[model samples]
Target: MVKDQGLSIVHVCQSMDLVDSVVRRWIKQHEAELEGQPGIGKPLTAEQQRIRQLEAENRQLRADNDPIKKSLGLLCARTEMTYRLIHQLQQKAVPVQQACRVLAVSRAGYYQHRRRGERKADVVASVQLKAAFVASGKSYGSRRLCRALQAQGVIIGRYRVRRLMREAAVRPVWKRKFIHTTDSRHALPVADNVLDRQFDVAAPNRAWVSDITYVRTRQGWLYLAAVMDLFSRKVVGWAMAPTMPAELVASALCMALQQRQPPRGLLLHSDRGSQYASLGYQALLEQHGIVCSMSRKGNCWDNAVMERFFLNLKMERVWQRDYANHGEAQRDIADYIVSFYNCTRLHSTLGYLPPAAYEQKMAAILPIGVSENT
Candidate 1:
């Protein structure tokens, strides 16, 4: 009556038996509501009342749909993962039947999964599978994981291991492509491809391949030079420096020489990077009575073993880290080479034996007077 009929506030107050101040306040509130402003008290206009009713309906709809949205997201996950989630919900005072309905999973299936998890053998297998995966630095897939379980007398197959991995939500870290760091365009003299891709060697120290790769750090790039024995695919020697100078590679070579002390005529191979071709490096090779072989220009396959080693290094260790400084990266990489790669990591090429283990096993079997080559 106050807004549409434009009745005077005093007249309306007298007619409705309301106080004059209350009628004036209500008139102001009604005018504010006409302009789409909501007040705390009852809505006086039809449009304002309709707006309030819609808001209440919207709130109720959102409340009704929230559980459904959450359940839809959970249902979209893997079936085993969904079952695990439902079990977790059940532990939190949520009814199993309700959780199953919300997750769109059959109650019978959820119960079955829980029973399988409770079995002694299944539980043991799951634990062993996870333990083996972690022991491989989370790097082993189903094939190697199965072999590792068998080595421990677990009697698990590859397919079963894969299934358990899914149930346990275990997965290996993925590998990124290897980046080439070789700069062979310098005018320095590069040795011929004398090693000639003969990556297999009958005796340790008979042939070795070396390569350089860079690691990123907060401070700067750290260059790593490594020498691997082709006989065992072992990282015999490695050195890290803030810069990739000729001395960096020389230090790695010196370590290899000091460690192995191979006989004269040992063959060492590397890319034609200028550091490897430096006169000082060549002099060190000559002084040690070692033959220096270089990969052909633009061909990484000539030093393929070294390339593969770098790839494995980055994929399995270096790429997975975010180094804060040179020293940290150096130490971590050294640990990987000594503690993991040489000591524990399985190499398919060596019949799944680690390089160090393979070397030891071969040494124990070799005849005392006969050479590995013979």
Candidate 2:
């Protein structure tokens, strides 16, 4: 009314008895809504309506043309994919020339790419198998190898994996049996089995298990004392020597204490061996404010976690070697513990994670102490 009919705001407000600002605000609010309406409003002209129709048609045409625009790129990528497929088929006894001709590719290119792809595949498979074997401590058979490869998105059958293993000459480590003897004939006082079989712990440094295992060398016997945290199953400390004495166990405990610096009143669980129950070992534990928890007399099941670790250490690394002397045995065992077991070897108890990784992962989420490797 104001623009088209040339009406005055003052005359409208006088006729309606309304404030000037209120009438102006009402006109401003309805100005957009009244556009393009008939009679009391202005509508789009024919040229403007034609442009809007053209824009709608343009959008529809572009959407319809999109698939055709991408078809050329798709065709080129498909040809390369087909070339690789033909190469793989040729390796399985398909005629390379016929496959190349049928796929509409050059026979020379097919042969060249096939050779390159095969060499690349062989190298890739060799590396993958070797990594899988080393990660498994060379303990995986073809079934495990196939599963490991498949987990990494490498689709390979077990029989094919077996052939690759044979070609690579990477055989699984054979298991060897051994015995661990604990001397419980001492007259030293034995603590009650406080830890018992409770392998689960709420936090690190709350409880630890220790044990002594012997390794036979050409020069003499090498003994290893290990301390494991119950929470993460990490070997927090270890000591290796040619003799199994109270100092051997004390040295391992000292290494654990110096590395972890765990809080006081930590429970130390072990078999009732004289080394663990000797005065020196007891006094050392007392000095660190650590308590003692002994396993039952001659009961190996009471300390099963430590026993399992020793079993893995022997079967995976020790039993496969012929150490010439204690030095060789100590060096190899230390490598297995530091380089492989604590850092690389997967533990089923820790959900297939190495103990160090498991502890670090737990430490990130839980309010627990961090464990250190030997």
The digit string of per-residue lDDT tens for model 1 on 17-135 reads 98998777777777788889885365469988899999999999889988876786567755788799997998899999999887668999988887877676878899888888888
Query: Would you list the C-alpha lDDT of every candidate in the order shown?
Result: 0.86, 0.84
Q: Top model by lDDT, which number? A: 1
Best by TM-score: 1
Displacement of the residue 10 alpha carbon in candidate 1, Å? 99
Query: Model 2, 287-354: lDDT tens per residue?
Result: 98888999999898999999989988887888888999999998998898888888876666777677
* lDDT at 206, model 1: 87
